[model samples]
Structure formats: C-alpha cells, structure tokens
Target: MKNALLIATACLLGLLSTTGASLPYPILPPLFVNGAPDSLTHFLGLPPKLLFALALMVNPIGLLLGTAVLGSLSDRYGRRPLLLVTAVGAAIGHVLTAWALASRSYPLFLVARFGTGLLEGHSAIVRAMLADRLQGPLRNHALSWLNGALHLGWLVGPLLAGFTIAWGLTIPFYIAAGALLLGAALVGFALERKPRAAGPSWWSVARERHAFNLLRHDGLRALFGVQLAYTCGVTAFYEFYPLWLVEVGHYDTRAIALVNVGMCGLMTCSALFAGRASRTEPMRRAAWLAACVALAIGSLGVGHLWVGLVGIMAFGLPHAFYNAVVQAWAADRFGGGHGQGAVMGLLSTTFCLANILMAAAGAVLTLVDTRLVLLTGAILTAWAANRMRAWGSGAMAGLPPAA
Candidate 1:
C-alpha cells in the first residue's frame, strides 16, 4: 500500500508539472504576434520573434540552475521537504505569471517564467523518490508510468489552454496555478518521508566533475550521448513545430492544439507500451532506434499540412519510447548508489542544455526558414539512431541487466 501511494504521488506530480509547463505553448504565439491586441512588442520594444525566443530560453536557464541546486538539496536535506517547497514555489510562480499576463507586463512575465522553471526543477527529486522506494522491474515500470503521466498532461493541457484561452489569456495561468497548488497539497498529505543514510555533501556530489565520470562508464557514455543527440532533435522539433504549423501549414491555434492532442495521446500510449515491454532490453533499444529513424523520415517529409500531421504523429509516438527507455536505463544505472539525486540532476541538466542550444538554433533558423529546423532535426535524429546501433553492439557487455 505504501508503494502504491508513492507511485500515485509520482504520477500526480508528473501530470501537474507537465500540464503547467505546457500551458503557455498554445497561448504565447498569439500574444507574441506583432500588432496583436495583447502583443508584448509594444510593451517590450522588441520584435515578437526575439521576445518569444527569449521567453523560451529563460525558463530552461532557470531550470538548469534550479535542477542543479535543488536536486542536490533533495539529496542532502530530503526529497519530501524539497518537493513540498518547490511545489509551493511553482504555484506562486504561476500566480505571478497570471498576474503578469493580466497586467500586460512582459518583463514580469519573463520573471515569472524563470521562477516557474526554478521551482519546477522537481523532476530529479521526484525520480529520486521513486528510485529510493522501488527496485528492479517495478522501478522500470513505475518510471514508464511516470513518463506516461507526463504525456497525458501534455495531451490535455494545450487542448484545455486553447479552449479556455478564448475566455481570457490569464485564465489558463490561473487554472494551472491552482492545479499546481492542489498537487502540492497531495504531495504534502500523501507522500511519506523515508529516512536516508547520510551521504557526501551535496556540493561535493553536484560538481561537473561527477558528470564526467558518467562518461567513464562505456554503457553510460553511449546512453548519455544518444540522449543528448535525441534531445537536440526533439527540442528543435517541439519548440518550432507550432511556428511551422502557423507559417508553413497555416494552422490556427485551435488546429495546432488539436494536432498536439493527437500527438501527445499517441506518445502517452507509446510510453505505457514501452514501459510494459521494457523487460526486453534488446527489444527496447531496437525500438528506440527505429523511432529515431521514423522521426528523421517524418521530420524531413513535413511540407504540407497532412504530411506535417503524419510526421508529427510519427515522431511523437516513438519520442515517448525513447524517453521511457532512457529514463529506466538511467535509474537502473545510478539509482542504487549514493548521490542518486545528483546524478539524476546532472542528467536533467544535460537535457536542458541540449534544449537551450537547440531552441536557440531553431529560433534563429525560424527567421530564415522554418524547414531548416526540421531538416536539421532529422539529420540529428538519424545520427542518434546510428549511434544507438553502434552502441548496442558491445555496450551491453559491461552493463547490468535492465531492471
């Protein structure tokens, strides 16, 4: 029963975190458009595209810093306390975001987003909590379910945002804030704090030096490399897909939301399936590679609306598989040892770094040609697939069996 409660808490928190994070995607484009009644350009005296890109960039920067600091804190202080604190911070951030939007303050909006990112750095903490409680196949399965919950939030968030955005731009923000607070309540009430053996100082374990050690392990290095490349591809694709739909496919916000729903729905299903199938490590790796290939093909072929939709679906389905498998792999590799929070924090930082780089590249490329972003994504994904294939040949020799 206790284990079940922990799993439930992880899933709920995952859903809340993802939903709040995704709410802005569908709503921001309209607000960022030049001459739109609610546009930020008049207030900020910056081009809409530049402002949009900066807005996207700031969150990840905050997340990078927050994950590093807060993740380590969780390792030292305790996951439960950190979870409670961050969840409250996230709620406050969202409230501030809503106020910023309501008052039409661009700078305040950016600050709020940064705060949200800082607080939402609970991913590593949550993963650590699960890793601490569950083991072996059960742990893998729980991670998969956690991944699914995230996608489920993504599937629902944009649709809700799109529909409610008509009521008021601030409405979605308020709703998200409320939901986050509710999640905080759930965590505080439901997740029991487990005592942990004292470990190394967070500062000692949280250093960049430790991240280098992950590369010393042959299997871990390959896995990390694959994940980095894959993240670059995914960040480019997801960040710019809305722009692509608007500019190239002529999709309105509602249409984009619908498409996102479909894609996220597929991704959620794929994550659940991958989680169940993860017992077969070889098969999971193969599926991951295949998914990358599909991402490349679909991304490269997205010229028209129908083709873009198909490409989106193709990429989205396998995207979850890659995430689920990689997360399970990471947990299996590092969860048993001391400083699991720090290691997971480092992993989260790597992904965020990739996101920051790819998102910046995509934003710049969007000015010249949106298709360039997709094409670049395709190439990167294909490279990741190739790397995975090579890594699979002998990488498993030193690695433990997948939990």
Candidate 2:
C-alpha cells in the first residue's frame, strides 16, 4: 500500500508540476514584446516592467518560502494533508490567473503567480511522499521518474502554451487548474494511507548537528554540495542561453524551442541510467562522468550553433542524471518524516541561493560580455567536478567500494 501510494503520488506530482508557471516566459513574452499593451501595464495601468519585475519577484520568493514552510508542515501534519492543500492552492491560483488574464488585471495576475508559487508542491510534499514510500533500488527508480517528470513538465509547458495561444492565453491556466485539482484528488482518494508520524518542530529541524551532522555524514554534504554547484551552472545557462543564441548564434524562438526539445530529450534518456547507477559502485563514476559531460557540453558553446546545441544536449544529460542521483542519495540519508522535510527544504534553499548568485553574475556578464559568462560557467563546472570527485573519494574510503 505504501509503495503504491508513493508511485501514485509521483504520477500526480508529475502532472501538478507541469503547470504553466514557467511556460509563461516562452509564450507571454511574445505577447508583450511586439507592442501589445504589456498585460500587467494595460490591465492594471502599472508603470513598467521594472516595477512588475519587482512585484513579480514574489513568485520565486513565495516558491522558496512556501517549499520551506510546507516541507516542515508536511513532516508535522503528514504528507497527505499538505499535498491536498498545496494542490488545491495551486488549482485556485491557476483559476485566479485565468480570471486575471481574462479581466486584464496585472495586479491580480501577480497575486495569482504568488499564490501558485506558494504551493511549492514539487520539492516539499511530493519529494516527502516519495521518501516515505519507497526503499533502496525502488526509491532510486521512483526518483528517476520524478526527475524525468520535471523535464517533461518543463518541455510540455511551453509547447502546450505555444499551441494553446491560438485559442487564447487564459485557456492554459484553466488546463493547469484542472491538472492541480485532479492531482489533489489522486492524493486524497488513491493514497488511502495513514499519517506516518508527528513531524519535527521547526526549531528542532534547524539544529544542524542533531539532524544534518554532515561532518559525520559526509555523503549527504557531498550530494547537496553537488546540487549547489550544479544548480549554479544550470541557472546561469538557462538565464543566458536564449540571449546567447539570439545575439551570438542568431537563432529565433522556434529554434530556441527546438534546442529545448533536445535538452529535454537528453535529460529523459539519461535519467534511467542514472537511477541504475545510484545502486552500486558506479555511483561515483556516474557522477564524475555526468559532471565532466556537463563541462564538455558547456564548453561546446565556445564555437558555433551546432556545436552549442551538442553542448546543451551533453550538459542536459549529465544534469538530469545528477539531479536524480543527488535526490535519491539525500533521501537515503534522511528518509524519516521531519528529516525528509528538512532535507527537501534545505535542497530547495541551496538551489535558490545558487540561482541568486548565478543571476547576479549573469547580470554583470551581460554588461561585460555574454560569451564570457558561458566560458565562466564551463570553468566553474570543471572546478566543481574536481571538488565532487574529491568528496566522493573521501566518502568511499571507509566502505568497501561498490562494484
């Protein structure tokens, strides 16, 4: 029953995570960019994209805060309730987003995005539920599917939006809302399980020595540290790649989407192998290979369009692999209720921190030169790979290395 619930929840999560939060970038930008009244400004009579950017920043802010609080809450209240709540919240948020779009209300739309962000369903309840349900190879397998779901969600979002735009933007929100509500229903009815235990208190979850103990548990730190560095590079590329293609490589939105398709394809293909690798001696080898692949892939951008596309493909495969490996590894280390919640929250926090740093560097690089940023990312990735290799070696020193 527990394993069944976990698998079911994973499917629901895959659907819920596919909502159009990230999709708006690819679709809505064209709406606003081509002299259409910026929806926010036209609807709300707001000043400009600057203030909107300030207010809309709440999306990611809410995401980070929501995931942190919800992760803890899931531990305390149990995964089922929190899952239902966030799913409902996401559903409501999307409905509101649709209404806001229809009514042409920028302020209201911002509120909807903030609400959507607050659900934080991906990292909190979904990951917690997975940790609660699965074990060993099965657990790793489940995470690989989840990793693929993440990319699948991202891939479909924009493609779906692009197609749905012919009908109107508001329709996508309605579709997203339906997905969320259905996900809620899946957890409510399909899981049919009791709460595991009382989760850890917020204050208690914070004390690192008691819970995390990375010094004693060096493997966990190595996993999370890889996440930190990997996210840094990935975020940098996501921020600048489109612009780099446009300015340096001379590609359009259609071309960009095609490139994204390649990325998604590589990631999906690599996730399964990564899951299998996590079970044995090849774990460390896989990580090193993935990181090196990312470095090499990222470096390919130093040349031309085809070269860069190959690089992106290479980078995406290793990245997708690492994501599953790290998450599975973290869950192995801290699979208990509150501990799982705390680990999920910490992972998201690390991702956000890395993204922030990367974004700052990206902004500066744009002023300096875009190619410089890509080159820097390649160098940083290589350096990070070396660090990870060292960490993995140290972790393996005590145990008979797996084969």
- Highest-lDDT candidate: 1
Scored against the true structure, residue 4 in model 1 reaches a CA lDDT of: 86
Which candidate leads the pack in TM-score? Answer: 1
Q: Write candidate 1's Cα lDDT for 236-309 as tens digits.
A: 77677777777766666677799889888888888787765534555247546555644644554457767777
In model 1, which runs have C-alpha deviations exceeding 4 angstroms? 34-39, 42-44, 193-221, 277-301, 395-403
Candidate 2 TM-score versus the reference: 0.80
Cα lDDT tens digits, model 2, 1-403, are 6676677577557645654455554544334323367566455564343333333355565575676566666666677777887788888888888888788777787788777877844565677677766677887888777777777766666566656666887877788788778888887886665646665664564343122343245445555566667666666676556656666666544556667677777776777566775334345654576566557546645767777777776776777777776677667655563377767766765665555566556556655566666776666666567665655555545433222
On the 0 to 100 scale, the lDDT of residue 74 in model 2 is: 64
What are the RMSDs of all candidates, in order?
A: 3.2, 4.6
